[model samples]
Target: MGSALVTLGGAESVVIERSRVKTLLALGGCVLFVVGSVAIWRAESPVIGILGLVTFGVFGAYILHALFRSGPGLVVDDEGFTDQSSAGAVGRVLWADVTELGTWSHQGANVLVVGLRNPEDYVARLSAVSRRYARVNLSMMGTPVTIASTGLKTDYDSLFALMNERLERSRLRLDSNPPRT
Candidate 1:
């Protein structure tokens, strides 16, 4: 686990890279998906077998991607935050559009959900499965940007504090300088 304050894209950024735990968990998921795929292949129901194959194909791709993934999983700068932690994450969320920040439990995993001013637009941009999850998050968690802390090297509370502080700063800056008409 490591962290660094570095300049990214001409901005000073706090980069929190993913931990080995995340890599291990991803590998574990790959193994489970493989096993499930094999089990489903042997099942008498053809429909079930096909479903398993689909699951394997989807999760298998994610597993392979995770294996090769590198660099900071999360990056916080003056403008906004970029999330590469979750599969098919929104990529980035500007501090200006961030409406709320809170935590929720999804499948026993603690996630930080960032509410946006216009979640629908972002949700529409996601892939089918990611869009589905985003919708579920909206209905269940009240947000479209749900970030799992499991992948991050930084502690969730500290990260939350940093984000909140930055959000406040962004708001203050905007308030102080209204856009010229």
Candidate 2:
């Protein structure tokens, strides 16, 4: 693992956090932009075509705005890895705190979920922040500790390796046949 300066709150879990509105606007905008552009091209009347073109611009902005809401950064320590940028946002859970570890792909991004013992509180917060992002997951353990990535950090392989190493050191192993679904 690369040597990195350990900062405060960089213990077992680290998360870069953000608000939900940002995510919604961003996703909705992207979809609208593409659809609108195509609609504008197919429209018969010039006025309708212009209106479609205008929607394309608005939607493009929404995508960008949503991207900004999901703060980007790396959250890792002895516990888990959080690939996020927002402050005070919970990221990953320490293996000592994790009961299950699973890696999956969602929304064209490879994601890892470290299931903790009691995860209700964190999961609730995550649900609130991810109104627009559809790639969230949750399952129960004892005291759930969790972490997620913003797909904006260094790399997934490196983070996974580091997290695994830390979890192994804690004697908490992932499932023998963890699904990569």
Candidate 3:
């Protein structure tokens, strides 16, 4: 993942793109898994082969989509941040709505979990597949907006720091200038 601070008009935004090398490596692993599943079917057990195929196939499709998808995986701007880092990304989360920012570990991968005031609103807007993932995220992390740096250009720490900084700035701004009724 590559990240840049871009200024458009008077607003500055941080844009983080996906890493092709990392994505390709993940795709390669998926291919290997599928091949191994085939081998298992040929020699060992059809049940395990079928299970592996279904599991790895879904992952392969997701990785393929990420590989071909252009543009930044995550963007943090003046109003809010847009998360496209994963298949279940909850896009355009306003800083005002974010109640907390915390971390979680999922299968050894560090995940940045954003706590929202109205998580259900975000989950309702997601696609069916994404919604299922969002439900799981809510159950596991207590929020539906969980971002992982699996295929992205940045590390978990950097991503978390950037987001934390932005969220703080937003909160300070809001504190100083209260919304007029």
Misplaced by over 4 Å in model 2 are: 1-72, 80-89, 106-108, 125-127, 130-136, 139-150, 172-181
Summed over model 3, clashes come to: 1
Worst 10 residues of 3 by lDDT: 62-71
Each model's total of backbone clashes: 0, 20, 1
Query: Each candidate's TM vs. the true structure?
Result: 0.74, 0.47, 0.87
What would the TM-score be for candidate 1 when compared with the true structure? 0.74
Count of backbone collisions in candidate 1: 0
Pairs in clash, predicted candidate 1: none
Which tens-of-lDDT digit does each residue in 1-181 have in candidate 3? 2699999678999999978888889899999999999899888999999899888998898788778877789989877899987677878899999999998886788888899999999999999988987998899888999887878899999989999999999999999999999
* RMSD of each predicted structure: 3.6, 9.3, 2.1
The candidate, 1 or 2, that scores higher on lDDT is: 1
Candidate topping lDDT: 3
For model 2, how does the per-residue alpha-carbon lDDT over 1-181 read when each residue is reduced to its tens digit?
Answer: 2225546653444333343454555566667666766676686656776676776665455345445654435555554555443322345444555666667676776656566665565555554444222223442322233233442333557656766767775563345545487
User: Candidate 2 at residue 95, lDDT?
Assistant: 51
lDDT string, candidate 1, 1-181, tens digits? 3568898678888888877676677667767866777777787766777687687667667555655677678898899998887665777889889997887765766678798999898889888977876787789877778876666787677777878888888899999999999
Candidate 2 lDDT score relative to the true structure: 0.51
